[model samples]
Target chain A: MNKKIKDEDIKVILNSMDFDIPSEIDAKVNEMIYSENLPAGFFKKLLRTSNPFIKWVPAFASILLLITLGLIQLNRNAPERKPLSEIKIEYELKDKNIKIIWVKKENFLLRRLKK
Target chain B: MTLPLFFAGEREITEKYSNKEVIISFNKFFIPEKKALYNFILKSVSFSEDSNDIYQNTALRAFKYFRKFDTSKRFKPWVFSIALNEIRKYFKNKIQSSDIHSIENSYEQIPDTQNRELAEAVYSAAYSLKNTEREIFFLFYDSGFNISEISEITGKTQGNIKVILSNARKRVKSFLGSKK
Candidate 1:
């Protein structure tokens, strides 16, 4: 006679086959962990202000902030460009198509036309 | 069993020295896996004493390196990998000594007759597998780890795990088939 087994049967059979865990296993592990006063973790070291990493973090952040602020300051330092309608640009026609263009505020003379 | 999203939103908790919170999260993450972890160690190492030592070492090492555990991945495979390494290290030492342990064979007999019989049958079927195949089999049925997770734990390719598991399954089926 051919007999077949299913996964469910295996699962049930296997799960039921577990060994009795020694009771002291938990206590021993607990004692071991507690002895360390709990692990502070690897990344936890960075949280310490005493760590070298903390010193550089502020410096990096300040550098980034300064760069952003400097960019803004540099932009501010640039003369505000007047809109086309705001500033007057004057052009005097010397000939049919030849003209001199200059900002109205500045006096510039077109002395000689290049040959 | 799956872990709670321990590092969600409050990553600083892990990166800080908050002992109480860290302890709670660690316990929450590790407690449910305890029995399974112990059983795996027990099945892998001979002698209850040595198994206990391996078990303690695996747990202690895991705790000491808890921060190194990636929060995004499954904890089962990570812990399983550590347990496997510990078992290997034990065996390597045993091999040098000439005579120490041959992969744990002690079983505490169960009281109930029907369950005991089933346990014996399952044990026989499981033991019929090759060493690596047997490890995969236990990880599959006992811990419910999928192929990918078992691959990660065992450091075998997923394709290799599938082939090994399939062959192991055929053997187990044949073992069960023969019993009829």
Candidate 2:
């Protein structure tokens, strides 16, 4: 018995027809975007990362952030140990409040940067 | 500004159009539909060179009328309707015929593949159908659109689309059976 294929089965076969788009659709789209000033989709624009400097910017920014953190760490660790006489610990007695403060050496951050 | 430009292709996009958020949104919404839509158009035009023109016109028209588009409704069928209009406009002067012979010359030889014979036969059956039938058939099958969606795109009732699609499939099935 030759059974006729069901419509659903025929539809499934049509799915695999796999026609080649047969045209440079994206190229045409890009041409419209750039030449006609039509907005190219950001996702598409994101994929075209051709600029060398732009590509390196992320690495450069990360390196800069790392260096800044390193300098801050160096400044924090650069404090010279001082004898009890040289270190000034001041306590301010005010109305109902007592605040203890450690005085920072003048130009301490500047000296750390010089290192 | 310096940081923004550093992020690859931003400079190009910004340099092209200022206040492009609307266009960007339009492209984002429309691009996903492009390949399926283009394939439908390509088949509709019988893979003619003007298929590109129809495609471009469709996009441009979509962009042009983008403001009037209801934000709540779906974009796919709306954009498809615009494309359908472009296809119809292209065929206004000449007949919108699904003549198998005209399509055969332009259809090119289907590449040798596992199911090439069956694919060719399926396409042959499709070719012999009326223009409207083939359009709905491809949208239903090739483009994977459902009956109501086809109705939305074609402005036909769901029942009407189902009947057309049913008839189209039966004819294709008959043709395929005759092949065996």
Candidate 3:
């Protein structure tokens, strides 16, 4: 037969048990708190550690910023290209009556030249 | 005669004002609970030296993170949660390099007392329990944390907490009855 134990009995027993903590714990904890040497915040601690990725972040950011600024500067200093205007070429028909041809200057000059 | 100030009045006024308030609040809540907290740690760890270390570590951690503590909540559960984490960390570190045989041998010796045979029995029974079971039992009975609060502390659901508490109580009771 399983005998049931009362919760009161357990509570009384546990409550009566003594734990001896050094009296100086309170003072020591208080001193630690007031000593201005508490562990730094999470972010501060993360920054403080010598992790390779974290260590390189600033340098990487600076390099990226420099590259971006250099790109912007180069873009600003670059010479602007002029847009091409339409040029009409008129060919004359004289003897055969079919010699006249009209061609765009860009197409005639660049495309025909390349071809 | 006016007393000399140790720091610049402006620096002192800003920093000390805030720090003093935090210090006062911490002391007010923690000082009174220190004994209970220590007792709980001692019971949880089942060793004086380890308990002392865990206790100090908990206090330091609680103080360090006290600013994050919500004033709307009860302080005891929050502090107990920190203590619980410290104990977990301690056990995790000890699991690999620790002597299992030594721990088994150490359980045989809980200091004897003439007047509190029941207390001794309960303690011995408690010490025999698995760490998680003992911790749950202590949090429930000795520390007065409710099921939900224990769930929050242990990061287990209320149902799980209840099951663990029931099992722990049954084991302790059975152990005690066997001893009788």
Candidate 4:
């Protein structure tokens, strides 16, 4: 019991199918191939001479490291500038120089604010 | 460069690679076939610009990898396999880049409007197919690659290629039907 479609149907469909080959593309193709050959040849030689780990692994590792370093630097630098405590300042008359204080308590306020 | 004694056909590869005549001959072998290979890839991907890129890259890949290729076997399929690999790579890149060229359209669809409207429409429709199905479709029917040859080119089992082709035929017919 075969259920294949009609041959005529296939012919109709296939006939309607058309392929376009742009003439301008030929020159471009030639250029692309020549250009590709240079890189491929270079890479092939590089692969042959270079250590496998150095060839494939280090590139990825370097990228991962850059990303890791970027994130670490981001974390370390961004959050630390906004400190939690209100200002606590102290001033004293020492060596004939006046120093003032500013802090949490009201009595500590003069110590905190008497700058 | 470390010259290895073990590249079994290193002599042939090196000889042909260095000799301008052999390289030219190898290129000549591809010149006539270029249009056909171009058509095979173009019909599936159906981008005029990308087709050219694929064709050129395929040729370069074929040239570079010709050494690992079996010298005794017919060169067309071997070289085409290399081209096909490059085309897949091209599509992978296209997909990665978020390009609008779809791997989902039918093989028969082409660009809209112009003297080549119908032709382009059909071509674009074919271009719309999934990458796998389109490849098998074009390889088997358009490029006249047989099942085994396509399997060899694609690294799929012949049975798997047959199934893909079956699905492609169905999808193409339906796509054409909706257009009508």
DockQ of each: 0.22, 0.11, 0.18, 0.06
Query: How many residue pairs of model 1 clash at the backbone?
Result: 0
In model 2, the clashing pairs are none
lDDT of each: 0.71, 0.72, 0.73, 0.64
Q: Summarize candidate 3's per-residue lDDT along B52-155 as a digit string, tens digits.
A: 78899999888767755767888888999999999888777778767433443233334465425666667778878888898899988887778999988889
- Provide the RMSD of all predictions against the true structure, rounded to 1 decimal: 9.6, 17.4, 9.7, 16.6
Q: What is the C-alpha lDDT profile of model 1 across A9-93, one tens digit per residue?
A: 7777766657666778788788766666554654345234223444577799999999999999888866788755334556767
Which stretches of candidate 1 lie above 4 Å from their native place?
A1-3, A37-115, B1-15, B18-21, B46-49, B100-104, B109-112, B177-180
* Number of backbone-clashing residue pairs for each candidate, in the order shown: 0, 0, 0, 35
Worst 10 residues of 4 chain A by lDDT: A1-10
Q: Given candidate 4, what's the lDDT at residue A46?
A: 31
| TM-score of every prediction relative to native | 0.62, 0.60, 0.64, 0.58
Q: What order do you get sorting by lDDT, best first?
A: 3, 2, 1, 4
lDDT score at residue A64, model 2, on the 0-100 scale: 100
Give lDDT tens digits, candidate 2, residues A25-77.
Answer: 66776566546565556334433543447568789999999999999988886
* lDDT (tens digit, per residue) of candidate 1 on B1-180: 432434222454444546555567677778888888887777555324588889888987777566556767877788888998888788778779865545445455434656666566667778767778878888888777899899999999999999998998889888877887
Question: DockQ of candidate 3?
Answer: 0.18
Q: Any runs in candidate 3 off by more than 4 Å, and if so which? A: A1-4, A39-115, B1-17, B100-115
TM-score of 2: 0.60
The predicted structure with the larger TM-score, 3 or 4, is 3
Off by over 4 Å in 4: A1-115, B1-17, B101-121
Task: Note the residue pairs that clash in candidate 3.
Answer: none
